[model samples]
Target: MPRILLIDDDAQLGEPLAAYFARFGLELHQATRPSEGLARLREGGFDAVILDVMLPEQDGFAVCRAIRAEGDVPVLMLTARGEVMDRVVGLELGADDYLPKPFEPRELVARITTVLRRRRAVPADARLRFDGLVIDPVTRSVERQGEAVELTGTEFELLLVLAREPGRVFGRDDILNQLRGHEAELYTRAVDIVVSRLRRKLEPLAAIKTLRNAGYALALRPQAHG
Candidate 1:
């Protein structure tokens, strides 16, 4: 059974959600305090986490960043705010997905399942090679043209997103949502920052072009037609 840690101060919602998840075969562990939740995470062996944005001591974004610094466990953040900034901030902090408040229990289940599916789909081979660049998803390492290139987790994920859909122009919001593991943020240039960082690393091999207010595109040079 997949084990999940749910951290939410809202007992009214958390209680019922815990019961609902149990019926789906997930082993649910609930923590109403941020400290307790972080402790449980450190104890290890959790398949995923459902973290609420609002908390008593520490906010969910802080917790998300803390966990991300330690590991890549899939995180699905819960927020009653539903504002674009809230969603964006959560994603920037590395939450895998976000669901607004008043959501149906069934929808939560679906999101959890989706995150798990993506995790399972990630290549076991730690390294991915495309053209001249090599990416190690596990260590979050990247190499281009036989040279090691440093990339932040978000930058690496952004590259992976674009490479996975070659020739596709990913708008800022789409790219944000993809790497964010959830919704887009409002009035934040996180995606732009990620792109700028990625471009610097990719410049030695390929060109990462901006589409004039549209978003970004990684244009692969045409192979010589022999």
Candidate 2:
């Protein structure tokens, strides 16, 4: 069973969602406070996180950014505000997906299923080596010039897709579909944000490249470490 962490303040929502998720072999853990949520997350057994946008004290945006900075645990933002700008902000903060509030429980289940599925689908013995950079999909770890590089779940996934087919250009749409497993309402900038974050962490050995009027690609090899 996949374990999920739900960081929302409402027991009304959590009670039903928990019961619904149970039917699908999912274990739901609830945290009503941001601090508590972060604590539970630090314990490290969750497959994905469902965060509410209107949490008390710190809003979901701050919470999401903090979570992304720590690691790439998948996040699905739940919000009563369904504006495009709100969705864009959530995506930019490294959320894997966003679902508007008052949504069907079934839709929430589907989104959770997609994010978790994407997390597990990796090639066997899945390792990629490029010049001074090394990526092991099985371990979900990266190293640059023999030093370990910490990557969030989303950032790692993005890099894996690019590294899998080095030199092959992947448009934003292709990457979105590859990560989310569906045609989503994601702005192209979402891909850009993940790429930018990955680039910062994979620096010096910089293997990712951009194409004008095209898309992004991983260089066949990174620059030799000095």
Candidate 3:
């Protein structure tokens, strides 16, 4: 059974949602406060997190940042406001996906399932080696300049998509499609945010090059195979 942590302050949402999730072979755990949620996350064993924007103590963005700072546990943010800015902020903070409030529980399940699927999918092949960057899809690890680089799940996926095709300019829409499938509602800014985050993490490497009004491409030269 997949374990999920839902961080929301709604007194009435947890029980029903937990019961609903149980039907799909998912174990749902609830934490009403951000602090409590973070504590539970630290205890580990969570496959994914469902975070709410409106919460007591710290907001969901902060919690998401904290989670990314610690590890690459996939995160799905919930925003009752459903504002575009909210989604953008959440994605920029390293959330893997987001869903608006008043959403169908089944749709929520689908969104969660999609992110979890991406997180667990590992390509069977050799490692990708660039000028100063090395990516191992099998292990989901990245190394830059001989040092291991920690990246969020989404960040790692974004890098892999580009590194796989060096010099290929992928427009924002192209990246969005690759990362989140054909989710038309997902804005292009989400791709920019994730790319920005990935760029910052792989700093001084100068791997990703932005094409003017075009898109982004991996500029790193591939290391020759022996």
Clashing pairs in 3: none
Q: Which ten residues in a row have the lowest lDDT in candidate 3?
A: 180-189
Cα lDDT tens digits, model 3, 110-153, are 88887888888988778999888889998999999999998888
Query: Scored by CA lDDT, what does every candidate get?
Result: 0.74, 0.84, 0.88
Where does model 3 exceed 4 Å of error? none
Better of 1 and 2 by TM-score: 2
Instruction: Report the C-alpha displacement of residue 117, candidate 1, in angstroms.
Output: 0.7
Which stretches of candidate 1 lie above 4 Å from their native place?
Answer: 122-127, 130-132, 136-158, 165-167, 171-207, 219-226
Candidate 2 vs. true structure, TM-score: 0.87
Return the TM-score for each candidate structure.
0.71, 0.87, 0.94
- Per-residue lDDT tens digits of candidate 1, residues 69-109? 77778888898754768877786666667788868888888
Give the top-scoring candidate (lDDT): 3
Lowest summed-lDDT stretch of 10 residues in model 2? 217-226
Write model 2 residue lDDT over 1-226, tens digit each, in one string. 9999999998777778899999998999899999999998988998899998989989999999989888789999997755766677887787888898778888889889988887887768547888878888878889888999887667888888898788899999899888877656656877888888788878886678889778899985734323
Model 2 RMSD, rounded to 1 decimal: 3.1
Highest-scoring model, TM-score: 3
Q: Residue 25 of model 2: what lDDT?
A: 88
